[model samples]
Target: MSDSSTAAEQTYRVVRNDEEQFSIWWAGRALPDGWYPEGTEGSRDECLARIAEVWTDMRPLSLRRRMEEATAG
Candidate 1:
């Protein structure tokens, strides 16, 4: 296979953080400081679909926490 095709075929995985944010990460690369793998590794499209299905709420964890605190206080 050609070098360009090989590069284009890189794999990815779905990742999420404490704030409930989602992102796609390269399959073999080290995850960043706060992010961790949320689901199986696959093509970028597959990971994005998984995030869309589960990440129904768009707010980050901090925002959700503040909203809850305001409502309670």
Candidate 2:
């Protein structure tokens, strides 16, 4: 196998937090507390791209909820 092919085959997983933030995690590693898989697995670049597409809101979930409550009240 070539070096490029090996690099391309490098595995990654997409994980999300309670705030809905997205991150790429190395495959074959245990997920940290408070993070869960987003059901995506691929190359590192691919996982990052998937995160970019889905994680549009940068705000944490609690902050967003507070903002919404304030606006509503």
- Pairs in steric clash, model 2: none
lDDT of 1 at 23: 93
Query: lDDT of candidate 1?
Result: 0.88
TM-score of each: 0.82, 0.85
Clash pairs detected, candidate 1: none
Candidate 2 displacement at residue 8 in angstroms? 4.3
Lowest-sum lDDT 10-residue window in model 1: 39-48
Query: CA lDDT of 35 in candidate 1?
Result: 98
Give the TM-score comparing model 2 with the true structure, all chains together. Answer: 0.85
Per-residue alpha-carbon lDDT of candidate 2 for residues 1-73, written as tens digits (9 for 90 to 100): 9999987888999999998888988888999999999999999898989989998989999999999999999
Top-TM-score candidate index: 2
Worst 10 residues of 2 by lDDT: 19-28
lDDT of each: 0.88, 0.91
lDDT of 1 by residue, 4-45 (tens): 787568799899999999999999899999999996688767
